[model samples]
Target: MKKLAAGNWKMNGLAAHLSEAEALAGAHAQPGCEVLICPPATLIARMAQTLGDAPIALGGQDCHSADSGAHTGDVSAVMLKDAGASYVILGHSERRTDHKETDAAVRVKTEAAWRSNLTAIVCIGETLAEREDGKTLDVVGTQMKGALPDGCTAENVVVAYEPVWAIGTGKVPTMEQIAEVHDFMRTELTARFGDAAAGIRLLYGGSVKPDNADEIFAVSNVDGALVGGASLKADDFGGIIGALERA
Candidate 1:
């Protein structure tokens, strides 16, 4: 399976930040692995325009479970697709913590993404408490099983493991820790999805910076990275993409 380097801009970025997107497109016009950027909902269309004909793909931070409804302040999967987004992130930790989203909700949203012909980048991970209590595997496993729908394929779904405590904390897990979770996720997916799981891309997210990207990418089952703060800049994100290409 081809690797993927996804950048989640989160709630940041403004009209002026489009210049960063443009520079990123200019710098890596042709990348070895698939490159994606999920900026705020407001910038999707403009970023798409800025990256015209570039190899980069645009995605949305999140989407509503329904195609259309009375969910005010919510962007539906269809809306994201219309906004020039080919991918939509679902069940990010921030969504789970901030909006109290459940795995069941993420599953439906993922289905909604597929209904709109958009790929769903599903996020799952354990909290600091869970990890400290030796429940990391169980937490992540349950979340993974619940968030992914029945028809998930390599073509439509990408899973990202972002430990809640590690995100933006600058405290990364040991390489062994990352490998264990990734390998476990692989085994879980293989058992549940059969052969299709092998082709599914598994990304590591949580304080993923350019300087540490190489060693992280070298870990087993780490197809690529779902970068956070480092993704806000073209230079920083480009370093990560370069590392994945070399991996």
Candidate 2:
């Protein structure tokens, strides 16, 4: 499977931010690994246009399970695809906490994304307290099993493990800890998905920065990163991308 360097901008970025997106695309027109940026829904179309022929890809932060409905504030997978996004993120920790999203909801949304031909990047992880309680693997295992849909393939699904506490807290797991969780996720996927699991990309997302990116990518089964704050700027994200290329 191709390594992936994905950025989840979350609720940040405005029209002014498209310049940074443009610079990132222009600077690395030929990145070694697959490059993706999930900007705010407002910027998807413009960023897609700005990215033009660059190797970089565009994605959405979230989508509703319904194809089209009167959900008011919700955006559907069909809408995201029409806005030029080839991918959509689901079950992110923030969405899980802030909006009270459940694993079942994520699974439904993931299936919705696939229905629109959009790859689903489903996130799974444990809370700080859960980690402290020594339930990291248990929490993640349950989330992964519940959030992922049936008939998933590497081509349409990617799993991201983002420890909730580490997301923007600037605290990262030790290298060995990261390796343990990733290896466990790989094992679980292999057990459930069979050989197809080998082709699925697994990403680590937290306080992933340029300085830590290379070492993280070097960890066993750490295919790449789902960067947060650092991904907002071209220079910072480009540095991480450079490290992934080197890794």
Candidate 3:
């Protein structure tokens, strides 16, 4: 399976920042991994244009459930697809905590992604206290079960495990810990969805940097990564991609 190295720029980036996208595209992307950048909505189309014929692909941070509605200030999956996004991230911990997005809401959005022919990167994670209490697997399992929509296939769906405590905190779990979580997730997914689940790519997120990407990607069941801070720079993101290729 090809590894996916997705950059979640979140709410950052402006018109001028599109140059970074150009830089990334101009650079050599790792041969064995897929590179994707999810910039702010305003820059998706432009970045998509800039990345034309390049190995890099464009993604969206989020998308509305409805194809078209009166929801003010909301962008739909169709709109994101029209803007040239091949993927849409959903149920990120930040969105769940900061925006109060529920599991059912994420399901709706996942369906929207399917309707628009966009791959959905569904995120699940646990907080520091939950991890301390040894409830990491339970929390992640519950979120995954609730957030994933029915009829999802490996081709159209991806799962990302992002420890809420580690994100943006320069913290990361040990290789054993990450392997344990990802292995458990693989079992849970296989039980729920059969062989199709076995093929679904599982990505690790939270504080993933170039220095540690190789070790993290080497862990069992960790097929790729969902990067945050390190993704802001072309060199850093490209370095991480290179690490995955070596892994």
Over 178-212, each residue of candidate 1 has an lDDT whose tens digit, in order, gives: 99999999999999999999989999999999899
lDDT of 2: 0.93
* lDDT of residue 69 for candidate 2: 79
Error of 2 at 5 (Å): 0.6
Query: Looking at candidate 1, what is the lDDT of residue 51?
Result: 82
Best by lDDT: 1
Backbone clash pairs for candidate 3 read: none
Alpha-carbon shift of residue 175 in model 1 (angstroms):
0.5
Backbone clash count, each prediction separately: 0, 0, 0
Residue 71 Cα positional deviation in candidate 2, in Å, after optimal superposition: 0.8
- Greater lDDT among 1 and 3 belongs to 1
When sorted by lDDT, best at the front, the candidate numbers are 1, 2, 3
Model 2, residue 84: C-alpha shift (Å): 0.7
True-vs-predicted CA distance for residue 57, candidate 1, Å? 0.4
lDDT string, candidate 2, 1-247, tens digits:
7799999998899999999998998899889999999999999999988888889889999999999978999899999999999999999999999999999999999999999999999999999899999999999999999999987889999999999999899999999999999999999999999988998999999999999998999999999889989999999999999999999
In angstroms, the error of model 2 at 177 is 0.6
